[model samples]
Target: MREAGKTLDAALGEQAGLQPTATILKVIQLTQQHRGLSALVLGGVEGVKDKREAKQKEVDEAYEKFDALVKDFNNKAIDDAWATPKREWQDLRNRISSGAITVPESYTAHTALIPKLLVVNDLTSDLFGLSLDPDVDTYQLIQSMYYQLPYLTEETGKMRAKGAGLLAKHEATLEDRQVLAAIIGRVNDRLTQTHTALNKAFVANPALRDKLEAQWQSAYDLTNKVMQLANTHIVRPETLEFPGTEYVAQTTAAIDAQFAVNQAASRQLEIMLNDKVSDLRKTRWIMIGAMAGLIALAGLLARLIARSVSMPLQQAVHISERIAQGDLTAQIDTGGSSETAQLMRALKAMNDSLVSIVSSVRGSINAIGEASNDISTGNADLSSRTEAQASNLEETAASMEQITATVRNSAEHAREADQLVGSATSVAARGGQVVAQVVDTMGAINDSSRRIVDIISVIDGIAFQTNILALNAAVEAARAGEQGRGFAVVASEVRSLAQRSASAAKEIKELITDSVQKVEAGNALASEAGKAMHDVVASVERITGIMAGIMMAAQEQSTGIEQVNQAISQIDEMTQQNAALVEQAAAASESLQQQAATLQDAVAVFTLHERDAGYSYQSPAQLTPRKLSLVSINGIA
Candidate 1:
């Protein structure tokens, strides 16, 4: 029973309805049967880690879905249903969905009572509109009564209560209604004063205040007519025109039908409960039998295990104690059990292994002494070899010094040759005159681009002025008379043309300005590169002049000392700066080649066919617009 209670608590703590109670009962029964399954899962169930992680994920997903369902219920069911139906049904259902209400012991249990704020029977369809269902279940029936009140008081009523009459605190009974009637009298007097003021407003502003007075007349007429209609409605239906009052009978019938369903559900649930209880009784008996069988089996296994295990364990202990007392000569009898005989054999093996281990240790000590003497002889040999290696190392060091000096001179000559080769290559590949011409052209193009940007700026300014002029022209055209109609038409056409021209010109100017700036910047970069190339050429020439003197000095040093001459000769250089320039030029050419290869990729991203133009295009800049933009002569477009 305690186990069942725990299961029930787990399942139904936050659950709802008679259905949920049934579910909880089933869970309890399942738990009782499966008793230690949860322990087994923790112990080592197959795929336990995956199952646990999946279940946790399911639980989190359930929380999110449940939250969404509640929000949906509030938006779709609660707020919407309240607005459409005066019944408390929607709000009650919302509470159930939101987990705000406890699960009912019986599904139809909650609707038995309602707050007095809801005048359930006295409701009008106009105030709390009809539910689509003529008869509702307990949940829906409850919602029907909630919408009626103080509940369905129109916004106008709240507004009236908020006015100077202070109807909110009036507590309108027959006494307060009398006060309200007095307040209404005072309201009418205020209306008279307002009527005068509104009439004066018409005198002050005829067009506007006349509309206000019209609204006042309509509102006052409607209010008086409504009061009269209400009185007539209270007096006799024959004097009233409203035809839908018969729905009251329909509503009562609906409430009755709802009550009938509740009673039926309640009775049906009782029957289901009785059947469940009967099944549970049978289950309890089964559980007791199962428990008895388990207990009996446990006793039998314990008895069997004791006879098999304890005797062997005690015998093994005795043998172990005897061995512990230094009984090296002691022997154990196996009594024909292979496992027991194996233990005896293991003991004998241990004794033999220990004696052998002692003999092996003595041999190892004698061998270690011999190995120490051998190590001493090896160390003497190693020291003799190391002394010879040190002498060779000194010779290697001198060779390395000579090699270092040779590499340094070779590096210098290579640097000079590299520069000269690069300059020669550029001159051969592209003539010096052509290079100078290109540089001069770039400069001229750069100046022309600057002028183009200025022209674009002037055009933009003109467009702005033209727009202003068009606006003024339009206003002038509006003021023109019939005699000036032809002139006005001309002015209107001019204004339209001016607006079109201005917009087109502005767009064109922006395009021109961007192009000009790009060209000017490209020119400046080209000019700087040309100057760098020129400086490299001059530096290479200076190095070539220094190389001759270096070679002559090395020859004189050779006569002074032969070894030092080899070191000085290491200063000889072969290549110069022209080689480095050639490499850079090659690198730039390679980049240009790769860029040409991807021209097809550029075309792939843009669909010329879809553009319905000469070409479909998007700027690379569009991919990362904020990545630093070029500062045009103007500003950002």
Candidate 2:
């Protein structure tokens, strides 16, 4: 009975059921009774039966209370605390997480939920405060039924309201839905933890198996029903809808089915217990009838019991041993409807699961190994390419540096040429000035020659007049004869003198005309020279402008070359960095390959299914270096 109780506890505990919680209460009560399993066995079978019934009643009453609380929560408290909030919250969450609404829209939805401040306040301060506690017990279930569930519902309602607002404005988003999903998940986790605690309590007790199972079923059903309702409330039909509610319903159904299975197991256990009780009664009667025959019959019964139990147990142990050695193909033959048969079946199932897992892991590891090898190969190729690129960039940068220096030199020479042209222009301008002064001097000389010519003409005119006056005196002297002869001779001599004076004046005038002509010619030559000088100055100025342009162009070229060189240098640096990154990537790939190998070795202990029998593993040689085609990158040349 004790072993049966322990087995039941183990099974119920694994399910994280309510039976575990009741089992704890029963254990606490049993300890107070100070009755060991041996005492219960030595005591009358009626006493064991009585204890079982009493415990069953107590457990049934506890379940009845839990069921009543669930009914109240479902009928009344859930509508106010859970339904509205869960509906609203889930709707909003769905919209956000489904990518229908943006973060800002979600915020707007949150703001919209503020109108439900009363609900939020009630959920936080009243329902949550009352429902959730630090300890796990029947009270915990009560709290969950009265407060926690209601709070979750109210919260969901608030979220749903937010979703509705979001849907009105924007579409739902995956992120928003995730956020809401996380909230729901977090709230649901509390229930999961409570369930886990109950399972632990169940595992700690061996007595009160029936009581615990009933209590667990009731509590599990109630909680699952409330969860389903809450989930349904959270579904938004109008906006972004999800199968969250349907999924919860399915989960509840599955759990219900599991509970049914447990009940069946319990029934089987009860039948076995009845059989044992019947045997005990028969044994007691036999002892009462014949004391001598009782001992002999007892020995015979013990032998039969050992043979019936030990043979199957030994076979099960052998199968388990083979399974432990990674032999999943080991066949089990625990040929009875006994607990040993059940255990063997469970072990077989476990072996099947292991086989599936190992096959999956093997495939995954092989894929990983191949991927790591590919990555390593790709990284190596990339590294070599990066190195080549770096070398090319370095060469290009060197070439650009030389070009920059050459351009700089050209600029300097252009500047020097510009300066020289400027100097030549200045010299030409000075020559133009000198020619202008010479032109002015020639003009002054031409003016003086003209004045001299004019004075000579005046003198010539005077001489001519003198000659005419001499002729008139000579005629007066001839008429007066000898007395006038002296006067006539004076007039003739004066006329002769005037003629000489006229000849001299003509010569002087001719000389002055020649001098003036020469001066005018010199002035023309000087003006032409000055013009030539001005042309030279202008030409020199043009040359200077050209030189200046050349200097500017050369300077610009030098600057451009410098910039190109700098850019090339930067490219070289980046290429070097890329090479380093590639190297690091190669190392990482190698590490990943090692890890994949290790994983492959780890799962080698498990036997794979026949379907995976032909699985082939990659060799390390496949990960090694291979001849690769080189690709040339263009440089800045």
Off by over 4 Å in 2: 1-375, 392-429, 469-488, 539-566, 591-633
TM-score, candidate 2, is: 0.37
Q: Rate the local accuracy (lDDT) of all candidates.
A: 0.41, 0.57
User: Candidate 1 residues 213-233, lDDT tens each?
Assistant: 454455445444433332333
- Point to the candidate with the largest TM-score: 2
Q: What is the C-alpha RMSD of each candidate to the true structure, in Å?
A: 50.8, 32.4
Q: Cα deviation in Å at residue 397, candidate 1? A: 34
Q: What is the lDDT of residue 448 in candidate 1?
A: 79
What local lDDT score does residue 321 receive in model 2, on the 0 to 100 scale?
82
Per-prediction TM-score:
0.23, 0.37
lDDT of 2 at 109: 53
